[model samples]
Every structure is written in C-alpha cells, then in structure tokens.
Target: MRGPAEAEAEDFVAAHTAIARPALVPEIPLHLATEITPIWQATEAWLGEQGIEPPFWAFAWPGSQALARWVLDDPSRVAGRRVLDFAAGGGLAAIACARAGAAVVEAAEIDPLAHAATRLNARLNGVAVAEAPGDVVGAPCRWDTVLAGDVCYEAPMTNHILPWLRGLAAAGARVILADPGRAYVPRGGLAEVARFRVPVTRELEDRDERVVVLSRLLG
Candidate 1:
C-alpha cells in the first residue's frame, strides 16, 4: 500500500522528470531530469514554497552507474545473497542486484521522494526492491552484502557514514563502495575491484565522462 506522501512524490516525479535510459547503464531505465539546471531551479523553488529537498534522486551519478554496471556484469557477487543498497539514490544498484538474482534486496534512503522514485524505477525494471526509509547508518547489519555509490561527495556526510560502513565491514558483511574521485573518499582501507568510464551529464558533474571505481572495504 502506498501512503499519501509516496503518492505525492510519484506525482511530482512524473511531472518533473522523464523515463530514459542512462548511458553507462543502459540496461535499466529510470525517471530522471532531462535538464539539470531546470530541475535544480525548480526543486529549489519547490523547497522554498513547499519544503522539499533538492531531488538528487533524478540523476544517475557516475559512481552508481559504475556500480550498477559492475553488478550486472558479475552477478555472482550478489546472487543468492541478501543485499542492501545504502543511500540508494534512484535505486539503480538495488535494481541491478535484483536483476542479478539476489535472494532479497532493500534500498535504504532518507528521502521520501527517493523512496518513491526507487519503487517506481524497480517496477520499470521488472524487479522488486523493498524501500527502507530513514537513516540506517550505524544500524545493525543483517544483509550479506551492502552497496554504496557516490556517498563520499560531501565532507560531513563522508565523515558521518564512513565509520558506520567500516563497522559493517569489520563485522564481516561485504561492503562495496563506488567512487568517482570524490574529495572525501579515503586513501586507504579499500581494495580496488573494478573501474568504469561512465558517461554523465556535464550539467551535473561538470565533465562528460568520469572514471568510477568499485572498491571493497578491507575488513
């Protein structure tokens, strides 16, 4: 059952974005903003008028694109395992996990709009991704594998979540993070697994292509 907030989110997304395939991960389609500046401005206006945060859910960041592509190319990493996609913006990695045959998949995001977009995108990909709302950082880990993409972009956010992610790794849960040369990604404690040259919108990333790396946390 969908709540009123979720329904409102869906409606707002439908109004503001379009269903299209991202270049790096073209296998799955997502509802994304076609013009970054227009969407950002609109989101800002909405935030001032109606108290909505900027819709990060409408763009497929380079890290997420690489992560999703890697997962799809190598299903064995998540197949038959319970998977959690932390801070699952737009749920691209979660959908990849499901499509790759994960036994169970959950996408955790703090924004209601992201939750709604994730559900909608999962449905578009013909998969089921359970939405775990609210902040799940520092929460007990139950999933066999956890995926994080583009989470180190902000200094404060990186500082707050890295330790919790390290805790998950220390506890023996496989923690994989994808980063596109973010300023805050640590210089150590990671084992490089894969890399991708992801195509991205310049309006969002300021470059046409980004080199994204998928790394496993050293436990």
Candidate 2:
C-alpha cells in the first residue's frame, strides 16, 4: 500500500452520461445505498458499514439531502430551467431540480458506483436524471442553472471545482451550493436562500448538520 492506485474511468466507472430512476419510488432494488460507497482512492468520507468498506466519498453526502429538502420546500428555484447537478451522488440534487420543474436535468459524477447509483436513484424517485461523466472543473459548458451539494469537502476538489463553478456562473448559469461547512468550501458572494438540519450517518462525521443554500452573486 504505497503510491497512488488508480483505475481507468471506463473500467471502474462509466464514461458516458447515464440516466437514473427517481428518488421517491420507495424501493431501490437496483441501487443499494451501500453499493454506491466510494473506494478509499482519496480520503475519509466512507460510511462504516459492517461488510461495507470505508472511503465512502462516492455515496451521497448530507448536503445533498439538504438540497433535496430545499427543493421539496420550494420548487420555484428550479421551475422550468435546465439544471446540472455536479458531484451528484445518488442523483439527489438533479432529482430535486426535476421535481422542482426543470425541463431538462443532469447528474454528474466521475466515480462509476456513484454515477450508476445516480441513475438508480433517479428511477427510485420516479424522476429523470441524465448522468454525465468527466470532471466538470474548468469545463466550458452552458446551462440555465447548476446545483451542487457537499462537493467542497476536499481541498483538491474544491480548488479545481469551484473555479469551474464560477466559470459556469460567468457563462450566466445560476450556480447554487448546499454546503454543510466542510473545510474546503471556497469563498465567494453567497445570498442565503434556505437552510436545513439534515440527518447524517456517524461514519461521515458531523451530526445534525446545517445545510446552507447560497445564491451566486453576479459580477
């Protein structure tokens, strides 16, 4: 166990954008929450399941749950807009956007399990989520809105990802983040639109979290 171990994105994860089931279907036989957990290719985001291993960065984070609540609370934020959910785990944010009335919605992840689970969760909820691959960092794409939850937990990801998020905003996409105060959240203008207390497993650390919804400030 030394140097960085890695797998080709295709071998471990799907390279193409995928579509998943909705979240409210109540029985996700295809997508088990445990199966979506991330391997310890990175850090300590793992869920401590008995048979399940650690390094669970791929599973859905608490902030994603917070965003889902926000959507359920107020669907107008995404009403009739095209939305992109970055770092989509279990496709929560993207599903929320669809539930909120977005005409087109996508959930993206680089991890294979996470990406696949995103699609499954979409089916679970009876919502549609188009899954996309590749790192969205510094990517030049256009969308009406971008929704991110719990993506800023790691320093490297935040450093690379936040700038791209800003770029999306610069392209006029309304970027929103549901952050529960991880160490790596980048600083920028954020107008609070909503907040929530979400339940999180002890394995991920931090219980009774506060989910903050920020409105991206225009420059």
Candidate 3:
C-alpha cells in the first residue's frame, strides 16, 4: 500500500503540471509544467521540506525526446526485449519502449517525485512500466537494452555513472545514450547512432531547439 506522503506527492505533481505531448515525440503524453518559474519556485519550496531533487520531471528534455523519437521510429529496436530507461525523468523513453512492444520496460530514478510523474505518465499512456526506485547505477545488467538520456550534464554525476554504464555494455547490454550537447558528455567511447532536432523551451534551454545525438555507449 502507498503511504500518505506518496499519495501527496502524486497529488502535487498532478496539480502543478498539465498533460502535454513532447514536441518531438507527440504520441506519448506527459505531465509537463506549462510555465517554468512557477514550477521552479514550487519545487524549491517543496525541496526545503522534502530534501528532494529539482523538478527535472516537469519538462521533456531534448535527450529524452530524441530517444523516444528513435524508439518509436524503429520499434524493432526494443520489441521483444527487456528495456530499461535509466534516470528517466518523466519516462518518455520508457513509455515509447512499452508502446514499441518491449517485453518489459522499467523506468529508474532516484527522485520520488520523478517516480510519481513517471507513474502518472505511464498510466496516461496506458502502458505498464515498472518502477526501479532509488539509485540503480551499480545494479547488475538485468536488461537487454538500457536507455539513458541527458544524464551527462554534471561532471561528478557523469563520472559516477559512466563506468557503471560501460560495465553494463561490457556485460552484453546495448546501452544507448542520448546527449544534447551537454558539457560533460565523453568525447570518445560513443558510436553515433542517430540524431534529432528537438524543440525546446527558451525558458529552460535558452534556445529554440537542441540537436540531440543518440549513441551506442562503447564498453
């Protein structure tokens, strides 16, 4: 059974966001913040009490958008495979994988609110996406394909997770990484797979669009 806090968190997410489709991947609907400032302020205030991460869940980032587009364009990439959406914010890619007929789809995140948003979005899409709560960086390779989007933004975080991601690749998992020109993305060790031009909110990206590069992480 879900606790009161969990229910409250879900309520907060539903109350603060609107159901919208990502610009690039419009087939899947997500709970997205209509405006940036209000959600940021609300998240900051909520963070003071809950000590949770920022509201990355309130937007469909470029990397995730690209991943979703790629998977939807080619369902065979995920169909019949067990897939993982790592660091899934609003679970766009996970939903795409599920829609593409993956045998199983799991969305992993450390933020409780992100989990809530993912659950809401998955339900809205009428897809079954299992939740892998908390940090799953060091977990064994339980999936055939792992999708990581926009995760290399911070230096420390990139450093911490990259090795584990590579290990998963070495262990025979097809680890896919989508990057939107983030500063910390590794220059090497990534074979280009596909690219996408994703529309973005100027309030968040300071631009009209971002070109996301999808790559296969080399072990």
The candidate maximizing lDDT is 3
Model 1 Cα shift for residue 94 (angstroms) = 0.4
Ranking by TM-score: 3, 1, 2
Model 1 error, position 185 (Å): 0.3
Question: Tens-digit lDDT track for model 2 on 113-141?
Answer: 56655655565578887766686666676
Instruction: Give the alpha carbon lDDT tens digit for every residue of 109-176 in model 3.
Output: 98888988998899899999999867999999999999999999999999999999999999999999
Q: How many pairs of residues collide in model 1?
A: 0
What is the C-alpha lDDT profile of model 1 across 51-109, one tens digit per residue?
45557899888888888999999899899999999989899999999999999999999
TM-score for each predicted model, relative to the true structure:
0.95, 0.72, 0.96
lDDT of each: 0.88, 0.62, 0.93
> Model 2 residue 211 lDDT?
48
Candidate 1: clashing pairs of residues = none
Query: Where does the lowest 10-residue lDDT sum fall in candidate 1?
Result: 45-54
